[model samples]
Target chain A: MSVLGRVRARPQATAGVALTLPVAVFFVVFWLVPFLAAIYLSFTDYEMAGTPNWIGLANYERMFADPGFLNSAWITVVYTVCTVVPTIVLALLVAVPLSRPGRLNRWLRALVMIPAVMPLAATSMVWVIIYSDRGLANTLLGLVGIDPQSWLTSSDLAIWALVVMVVWKSMGLFVIILTAGLQALPGEVYEAAAIDGSGAVTTFTRITLPLLRRTLLFVLVISVAGSMQAFVPAFLLTGGGPADATQVLPYYIWANAFPYEHMGYAAAMGMVLLAAMVIVSALQFGFLKGGDE
Target chain B: MRAGTILRAVWLIVAVGFMLLPVYAMLVVASAPDDTDLRGLVFNGFHLPENIGLLFGEGNLPTYLRNSLILCVGTGVLDVIFSAAAGYAMAQLSFPGRRVLFALVIGTLALTPMVLVIPVFLIVKELGWVNTFQGMMVPGMISAFGVFLVRQFALGIPKELLMAARVDGAGEFRIFARIAAPLLKPALITLFLVHFLAQWDNLLWPLIVANEQELWPLPVGLANFQSEVGITYHLTTTAALVTAVPPFILMVALQRYYVAGLTFGGLKR
Candidate 1:
């Protein structure tokens, strides 16, 4: 096309063309820049005071060698595993039965969403009350003739308190997601399994489980991602210790960056987190895909 | 069929029972008389008025409520408008590097403020927005999740609508305001509620940003309530119950929209 033709056609390009710059700018400065800067800062000593000295691999070397960092990393993995697996499985166990079409089932499914909307701080406070030595859990345990457990204050049990809170807080979303998956499954498969004289467990194991892989995968990824970055309940309830038991990596980053002002080192840890998440997720996705094939 | 129905009925009851317990416990504990020890799960009365009075009596709770209202509403309005503008552009506009732009928006979801809390604080410090309303609202205004959500919803609108509006000489902004905005109401409300609740319940950011008592939102205020005040289970529960009321009402009133939003939100990723 001639230059004049292209110039004359410019009027048509006006609408879509105008919006591109501002959106592109936001993407560059806020999203892309911060991310790349995080990566670059990870490799340097860029504390706010001094020029960001380029220190090759020292921060990472320290990270690997640091006992506290290693502990938190291990705790993060455990926390992720405990929270994600049971939340998905338990949600599915609850959802599949509740997926049946009925008024009561509808009510139950809707009721499950209450937890997801409850403010995390409030819920954690409530859990603190419930798990207190004199709280509801102990009261119940007393009814069963078992002694009260110090749920949140003890090192051995503090992280489990965190795990319980996370599971309860996040389980509602999983229920909603997996229930939708449950509702979408073909009824004929279940009917066919029944006709084949398969029992309830057999039908669920042989039929329903296989069909729900994608939803399960989605739940797994979100749960893992969410748990790895869990902040509210831990921050509120445990304060990252009864001896640093509940101190996950995000908490470490928060403390180092905000409280301690080790911005560059914290940035290094954040990069490590980001890389760990992406690599782990990519591997999981690949493994799941391979399994499906 | 009969056995299966019985089993399903039993399961539903159990699930609902479990789900309602904590909420029921919250209300029950809140309503218990101040001097009475609410060590058990049983519900009580006569304490609602007393506890509520305690919360609002000295104007402390009222201040927290007001701050929460300002932050939540401000964040909602700012997030929705910017997200709509950016989303509409992404969906309707065919500008250069559009793919890269959209990719960047989606990419931000994977990167959360937890990792960048310090850097963000630095940015807020540089802008002199620390311990200020602008600091709280402005930084959160550009949520990637909000933009991504609105853009996905906006993409469903037919181009013919925009073309027809253009044929009538309607300006881009006008079409968006008159046509696209109204059409995107459901998604807007969804995003609004999500962001509002998120901000309403937010702790770390608000705690980090707003150091003053007057500027503190409910979560931070409540946190301080436990620490600074004379700690009583009754008063704490009262504060917790009061904190939950706004979001509870919002979730109930917008139940249908909330469910649809959750479906769109959860599955969209």
Candidate 2:
């Protein structure tokens, strides 16, 4: 009722308040209020008990000098760059071929999504086995005669292992997206290009790539956002690693908020994560420019 | 076949093989006998029932399953209703600040949900909702993506149909329920399924708030099974298969709709 009252109190929103009340409540409770609280929380020293003491900019200052915080920030950037670039490239590689119609292509289309559609937490567990000493990774490597490497335990490989898991699980959905983009390419344009004696690469670069820009931008932004928020794989597969190799920001932020009870620090990190996503996502808007379509 | 065709086939095979290899390992481990080597994907004999029993018995899987279902189904239903109602109102009904509300919806769709985690946790904790069902479910009940999906679809709905309902003396909410709703079925289904999967796949939120084991969702429970010390590979594999297999099978069963829903959901975000 109070939520309703406040929602109605908004200037010039009186009419149809009944209809918009739930949405307003959700906006206020979930988005508006929490968002503002996050701003305030980041400036304080709240540890889930006692009053929050204001210490403006201290949390943000501490992050630059804190090794663990810096490690997480650096790894998160590495994780995103490693993931989003490969995912888009790999998805394009698969999507272009799968765009055409065939029985096998149809099967492969759905096959790729099996990983994406499943729960990440559950699939991360499967990755745990895959990276295990005697698991499929080793089995396959033995066939190639490469000695087994401690994949998840090795600090160098732990983040890469999680990267592999994330790419495997997430790339397929992007494949589907890019495939849709490819298929939507005007067939006559491709025919015209081929008639002009254009090679496959030329046709792709000039025709297909230019036309797929919108969908590519869509995929790029979403993948960037998804990778920015990834926590489950790090949590499940590597437990943030033998060292801090895979302690991406979400996992590290959760550790601080819950285990260490550093609520204010986590809030500050969350703010930075949000700001980073906005900045990175804005850079991706560059994809939208210079496009005639 | 041309050389290009052969090359494409090889690429497809390698790519598809990469996707399915882990799933195959999961199946083999899940199917292996109880005493079979955990280190390998040895299939001595099928012991699926025994593993199922182990999960149900000692694994306390049912509780986790129920928790996930409660969170998933509840969030789905609430999401559909709220998004649909609001979408209809903002799209059709004359309301003050509709423009502002519309802007807010788009604003939320642009924001990453990770930043909301701390603030929402603080809110839930302040409400003493930690380890509670509402704590797990309520904050996630309405997504801007769902609202945006519904509003876009609802905008295409002929205003005459809704106006006719209003002319027949039906109330606003009633018109939405009876007329606007049936028209928005496809979008609503997409919204529901997408949010359902989101809730089910969610780990970070449930992990933060649902500290008690009883309230843990499958992802949380399943991750715990894998990450905890001294757990055998078989049990963890079984849990993994159990958590993963259903959604895949469900996706396969509803292959076209599932893909369409996911793509729509993904692209919209």
Candidate 3:
């Protein structure tokens, strides 16, 4: 109490006070201001040009009935499932063996992370080329004497193509994360499984999978959160075309908010996405925390 | 052992191949001199220099690259510094409302900026920050993930070290610069790479904030390249390659930091 009193008595707390003020003010002006304004504007019919008129829950009600909104929500769910499952599984399978420290492991791990750091927009563009009818992918298929399927334009296939690109770009970070978990695991558990004549698959399923639960949950939570808000690739590659196949939630929000000037409706959609992310993340955290106990 | 090792090697080869295909394709398309054979599978001929010259000659490729570098460096430095300072405060200092502030930071991470983009656009418009680099980078300069990363590292530093410094008449800021900051070198480097990559690859915000061609970053610049050069695959791809190269170089050079920073958020011990 005396040390605290003495610290409070110091004059520097007042002088040093001014230094922290700028950061506080900066955070408030940029983050808090926009966030609070958004919450307010979400309840009002505020097109860009004029003053807002209060219309409570009208935006939310309209969003619920909008087929585009519903479709985007479904597409987002599918995208989340497609991207998350493959990324986590592939990363874990790659990671378990690469957990050890060695020259070969180091190089292999580096290779895995290459895609994770690549500029996504550039990669998406490259993918647009590869997914072209006459592009490298089809050309390679030609080598194998298989037909070149439309990857981007086809309504049935466009979202999957986007999913494939996302998984390829994002799986590296998952690998690195899962590999870290593998390395940090107690070696004795795997040794015990090995001594019991457990094969690779057996050890993986029995020993590794259970131990990596928390890491898996973390990856899933983040992936789901990210996928639910997918925008850039969907915007660039598909443009939500071919009957709105690749139109995910964030794309819907962007369209409504920016181009349509339906600020209130977009805000309602944003709130929905925000709720989805929060619920999924909370569920994952709760499950993981319970597992820890 | 032979079977398992072979399987692992094959799996790695396949994964690595899939991983580099985009990069390889970017390079291939960029370097292909003529549109004579867009259907070719083999990547044999490439006039990379010619394509690069063509792209730069087209419109503002050099300036776009410069703008990207400026925005990325500016955002990276400012984000890392602010996040580090705030993380240190949250981790070490017994300030009032610390819990609330920390929760607020973490909560910000949950609301993906994509959802906030419209509101942000309105705010930027209100401030008349449109078409400015400051407008592009300033709003993104405080990342919750950056704070989380720094805090994870800062928590590892002993309180005694800071106490000893304070006892020797070192101010809190001096102590941070002299002792705590150096101790956080690895973490700071990792966070910097993450921030730099995020900023470098950011497209939507920059697209919304700046309409001037001169202010466009690499991603936005590449998007416009195709429009301007209509069907000039070589020039477009070449500019795309230019956009792709910096992040690739950064990844290769700082692989450890990049990987660690990336996984830190997702992988708990």
Q: Score the docking of each candidate (DockQ).
A: 0.52, 0.56, 0.54
Model 3: residue B142 alpha-carbon error in angstroms:
1.6
What fraction of the correct interface contacts does each predicted structure contain? 0.43, 0.65, 0.45
lDDT value for model 3: 0.78
| Model 1 spans with C-alpha error above 4 angstroms | A1-13, A17-24, A46-51, A186-199, A291-293, B265-269
Q: Residues B121-239, candidate 3: write the lDDT tens digits.
A: 88888888999978998888778788778877888899888777777877777777788778888888998898888888888899778889889998888776667745476566677
Q: Pick the candidate with the highest DockQ.
A: 2
Give every prediction's interface RMSD.
2.4, 3.3, 2.5
Highest-scoring model, TM-score? 3
Model 2, C-alpha of B164: deviation from truth (Å): 4.0
DockQ of candidate 2 is: 0.56
**Residue by residue across A1-293, what tens digits does model 1's lDDT show?**
49754653355346555644555565565567667777777788877676788898889998999888898899999999999888887888888887878888877877887787888888887887788777877887799999999988899999888887788777888888788877778888878887889988887887787787777777777788888888787788888998998998888888877777777889999888988888877877887777675
CA lDDT of each candidate?
A: 0.79, 0.81, 0.78
Model 2 clash count equals 0
TM-score of chain B of each: 0.93, 0.89, 0.93
Model 2, A1-293: lDDT tens digits are 79754643342233356667899889988998888888899999999778799999999999999999899989998999999898888989889989988988988887788777878877887777777787788887888999998999999988888888888877878887788777767899888887899998898898888788878888888888889888888888778878888899988988898888888888899999989888888877864765664
Give the winner by DockQ: 1 or 2: 2
Candidate 3, after superposition: displacement of residue B252 in Å?
Answer: 2.1
TM-score, model 2 to reference: 0.93
